[model samples]
Target: AALIVCVLVLELIVRQFPAFVIELTVWGLHKEIENKEVNVADKEAEAKHQQHLARFCRK
Candidate 1:
């Protein structure tokens, strides 16, 4: 009975393993996309500042 119980537990874990992996993968992708968005925003701000500096120098 102990062996059967162990086997059942193992089987359950194996079944759920794929779902766990998928969740991790989704989380990682979400973080990556968020980082990309932040990077883009930073670049845009930098560009705006550069434009402002250019206008200032034109005076």
Candidate 2:
């Protein structure tokens, strides 16, 4: 009986593990995308500033 219970519990954990891993992966991807967007925005702002500096220097 104990062995049967152990097997059932193991099977349950095995079934759940993949879903847990997938959730973690998706969550990580979302965070990475958010960070990438922030970095892109910062780069755009930096480029604009550089353009302004260039225009000022030309005058």
> Candidate 2 lDDT, tens digit per residue, 1-59?
99999999998878998997898899999999999999999999999999999999999
Candidate 2 clash pair list: none
Q: How big is the positional error of residue 47 in model 2, measured in Å on the Cα after superposition? A: 0.9
Q: State the lDDT of candidate 1 residue by residue for 1-59, as single tens digits.
A: 99999999999878999997899999999999999999999999999999999999999
Every candidate's lDDT: 0.96, 0.96
In candidate 2, position 18 carries an lDDT of: 93
Residue ranges of candidate 1 with Cα displaced over 4 Å: 1-16
Residue 29 lDDT, candidate 1, scale 0-100: 100
Q: Which portions of model 2 show Cα errors greater than 4 Å?
A: 1-19
Which candidate has the highest lDDT of all? 1
Clashes of 2: 0
Per-candidate RMSD, Å: 6.4, 7.0
Model 1: lowest-lDDT 10 consecutive positions: 12-21
